[model samples]
Target: MPQLDKDLISQPELWSLVMQLSDRRLTAALLPPVDGEQMILSHIPLPVATAGSYAKAVEEAVYDNPLLLSDFSRIGLLTSSPRVALIPACLDDKAAEEAFEATFGSEACVSLREPTWREAVVVSDDDEQLLAFFRRTFFNITIRPTLAAMIECYRADGLWVSCEDAVIRWVYNLDGNLMAANSFDISAPEDAAYYVAALRRVVGADRGTVYLRRAGASREWCAAMADMLRGASCPVEMVNASPAICRLGHSGADLPDYFLQA
Candidate 1:
């Protein structure tokens, strides 16, 4: 089995993770981000009240039971008040717990973590921001690692990029696991070469990661191209003629089905 690891941005929604499971056997409660709004994918937009409140939001709201599964209408939590399901780390738990007790009178309401920033340039706004955010967040997690250490970590990382007419989408892994995903352009053949160059230049040539393109291009074409990359001293692995990678939406994109196995 592929060793499963969730690329957690913070300990927040439990349902999002459950839904992402390729097995689709698990279920969970979807909690509202600090604002009391439920969001399955995407950042828990920084809370409104204040940074302090945002911090608190992460702590107190997450819950343990009666995991919210479908939309509110489906579950009908409005008719019956079950324990509030919240993001574990969407807010600072220590702070949220203070609010939880102040309001709910205990540390019991908040739940645990869920697996889930900014810019730079080469210089498109999207790519720039994506790369910089990955760099920044990765460091934030590593703390005090020198450039060499960071490079050592990055060299092992990989990502997926595709465009047919404009851009089907692009997704990247900050760590070895899927960490972020996004859509760009529409879809086009032009996107194919552009994305490949970006992966080669931006991600660098040494990662040993594979790139799978779905340009309605031929397998003979893509495979031969992969072979050429090797001739250029670049390591290119498998190439899927189909658009399997793009099917992963927010969670799906970031964490491709059978991605671990790939």
Candidate 2:
């Protein structure tokens, strides 16, 4: 039987640890169920370049652990690799496909089609590490509840990003539907301009309510991104609450099925 060391963690503390580990590039994380049917986030240290092997290890780790098999439903992968692309529903399938191919090649990691948006979760890291992981383990292993959950956590959407030393996360209510996700490298000076441009292109001109989450150390980067969004006329709110708190409290929190439906 495979055994994973479990710890009972509070919402606040868990977010702190997420930020810390994200800084170290342990982008993908697991939220395992604990007593009382609660969930506690956990991470296994796997360097970005070793994602393929990491996925194999995860398969082995959950091979016999019923708790992991039942509870480890969602996996969050943080990367500064291939940036994210969000295609609006307005685009026809052909146009959407072209746009996705142009931004990210055919070997994108996570591709999700929603009623309102089509997202390409591209992994642009060296040697296509994430792509190999997906091909070797993602299909064979049952990870997320659906493709939506996979990208929501596993890839970069408007929701989250883990840059060099900080993770910038966002959640938004879009036309009565909420999409929250995060990815990295968007805040770094070298990467910020491209990230901002991609973000604006995906979101377009909309009256969406958005909330930003980041560590204190990441305040500057977060503010920079926020300022850029506002410049593009995005109605974004830099909330005082932590990302973990917001994610855990809300009904669709933690990438639950309710969130996907919403």
Candidate 3:
């Protein structure tokens, strides 16, 4: 159970809630109304090795902190599963399912088209209970792939990487065209640097800058990444949350940049 501010408990309609569920943890952020100061954030770790544990953890968190039960102006649910495949939007349901299974072994999944990028994103997770829980608990909730927000935020010509938990989601744009949008599991700074270098080679994006979103990474880790990229002649720049989200006043200065997504 996490402690939340009093005002947030009293007036819920004035805020917007964003919840992100990953393999290792679930994160929830309460975005206050413009110029308001009471913002709340919570992170609950999931027992990854057990089946049906994700939903159990989420239910426990909600039970402890009823703030999650509040009715907000809007709610966004983001899933950060690594088992994601991006395909052309023209594919039909059957074809999309085939494509997803070909890339990742056959599994239950959902496919949604991202109109902004003109591509269809296929996401698969084995946790059926977790999906059911959200559907039963929240009203009019918008479920989206976390990659969609990352791509929406970096629509220019550059390489962008957003580090959250132990996963790094990256996108590359060249000449206003999206070259790649994918994620990788990284355990060390060296691993991240290696992926950046490999992605540059694979995408031929050797000249543009590398933008990094230090969502859940530490200062020491970010600094180490910057040093490594600079040594490779790739300029590194840190990206913060959207200006609109910043204006709403967040609990942490280093909140993930994908909160507002535009």
Candidate 4:
């Protein structure tokens, strides 16, 4: 087992526990209540085989990390699923459910309305047991789609991309309003760049910065993406994690920019 953060265990109520569940791994960050630093940044690789195995993997990971057992002031869970869609916020409950089912083909979903974005984010995952485990373990756990955080943090006119393993999540904001929030599965940097260019053309965003999250991305990948975007006259900028979201004693030098923006 890895060394646990003493502060996180000793003063659990002073911090906020944030966990991100993605297709590749489960990332957990113990952040301060306000704009401070992170107490712990840890992750465990998730088995990609089945949902039952996934729940079991998460259970083992939580048990392995003693700090995760602490009761924090706030708990947020970000679910990174490709089965996420954005619908108008004005839709009624039945209408929203129909829309979600039309796209995702299932009713096992959670819809969150973001008044700022003027849309509702619908995230669907078949891992009911995994979600149940989280609800059963934590109190008042706030679960949301990962893209919702990007939409909240980045409120400018640009393209924000977060790369992780074989998945690429992106949000396009135009004139300080969210226009698109989506993800794609890619095998290489070029595949992401291609989608970026295509989105720019489709959205008519000819000249806006493309901010890439510095965490979980390689220098080579960033460089290649920058090179590709340069042809479209769009400059690519790498955004680092906020200083307020740093590690316990050290700076959040290696953390993702979207740590706890939600």
Candidate 5:
């Protein structure tokens, strides 16, 4: 949505800062914003570059602009970013089930199946591109933690964080930013410890914190993991990012009277 686009455009420093926090896609060729209902292909940021035109934008001045204009008509740079999937009740009622072979001026596709209880999958089109993933509310709510870090990056660092379900997250905190992110599997005990151990390996001796969501209902195992971290001297918290910030195009409209009150 343009909401995020506009926000990023206004404070690109935050956007740049987040990359330091994660190994996110490192480039973006800007483009004109697209209104939701427009006939544009899909929900994506950055404009499509012309055929082999990555060469043209390699110079000065024109490349300095935050927005780029070209006539590829079908291919946009930075469109197929590696995306992470999380399980949240936010989109729980969402029933999107279909393997779409879509062409969103780039690449966008998903496998749709009603999540069994709360488990999902995340795939990658490339090491730098998030290919396919699911967001099931009943599963481990990973999006908010990563998203929280993203929002946090917007304020102090341009570092970004995201997950590929069950596996540890890919953190692009900074060149010397030794932070780590992981989406622990909440359904099992062994996996949770394994997740923390993986985190230890990733963050090394850096002062790092672990975040988990208590939404969608988790067992004491999650809290146990938190305690285990404390015993190991790792700062850990069960942070909640529910109803987090309101995203554009989400949530049904409020009652008509609410609008009238204003």
Candidate 6:
């Protein structure tokens, strides 16, 4: 419920840019899942950032130096055994802090900073061995930021849920950064409650929008989700569309980056 203008960059300008950027296609290799396992996380270039003037700002604000000591822990599997990880963007402060703890434990410091209008959450992790190594050589400490910190920079205030093989929901900001994500079976009653609960955690008693993927399987389950959210008196506006399109009655032309083959 707090106003984001004070901590964030120009919301109106960022939203306008995101809308325009969502239309372009990203140039990432489409690697198929190996051994029945798909990569859990991917870093893709925002095609719209290729436009004039926006490129430098996007890189400087959201993608800064790392807060981690080394890549051995986080990217060890990038070449041999990669797994995809999705993080939703629309989280309350507590949820966001908890997520940071999950990754860095007590070995790091988490901080949020906004340059211009884009807010970037950074993690400064200095593992002992790495610190000793750097001090022995350059006499300086090394701090690297995790992907979670970079994603948090998006500062999404809304939630976006969609279904693919199973039910996968992502919290995203209007600027199109996905902050957090979870997957589950929509057919199960417990799952339905879980979905509602997730939304509740994000929106609380406030009104927000929910999107059900426009697949046939999503209709009935999504209807159930809408019903439960309404029952709890949460003013939710549900839309049936590809995750790219969360708002109803849009031009249906733009394809969101999530739908890309990265």
Model 4 lDDT tens row, 76-132? 888776666777777777787788778877654644433445455544543667778
Best by TM-score: 3
List TM-score per model, in order: 0.28, 0.42, 0.88, 0.84, 0.30, 0.34
lDDT (CA) for every model shown?
0.33, 0.39, 0.73, 0.70, 0.30, 0.35
Which candidate, 3 or 4, would have the higher TM-score against the true structure?
3
Per-residue accuracy of model 2 over 54-124 as CA lDDT, tens digit each: 44444444342333323233433323333345445567766766776687677643343443233333222
| Local accuracy of candidate 3 as per-residue lDDT tens digits, 1-262 | 3544344456788778898887676788887775757567777666544536566766766655677778889988887766676777688878878877888777646544344464545344435666667778889887777787777777878888887667778988877787788889899988898889778888888877888888778878987987898898888898876666566564555567767761
lDDT of 6 by residue, 1-262 (tens): 2111233322221121110111121111111222232212223344345444334432322233121122111111001001123323455556756666676564333343112123333323323342343334322322222223223322345655544323343444544533343334455534765665665566441455554433223456556666776677655565434333333123321222233210
Off by over 4 Å in 1: 1-157, 162-168, 177-180, 186-190, 204-206, 213-233, 239-262
Clash count for candidate 3 is 0
Runs in model 5 lying further than 4 Å from the true structure: 1-123, 126-187, 215-219, 242-262
| TM-score comparison, 3 vs 6, better candidate | 3
lDDT for position 146 in model 5:
32
Q: Who is ahead in lDDT, 2 or 3?
A: 3
Backbone clashes in candidate 2 total 12
lDDT of 2 at 75: 30
Candidate 2 — what's its lDDT? Answer: 0.39
Worst 10 residues of 5 by lDDT: 252-261
Task: List model 5 lDDT by residue over 1-262, tens digit each.
Answer: 2212333344232221111112211222222233221111121222326322322222221233222222222221221223433233234332211222222223543322122112332221222212112112112212222332332332222222222222233332434432332243334545555556555556563365555443223346556656766777767655433321111112201111011111
> How many clashing residue pairs, candidate 5?
22
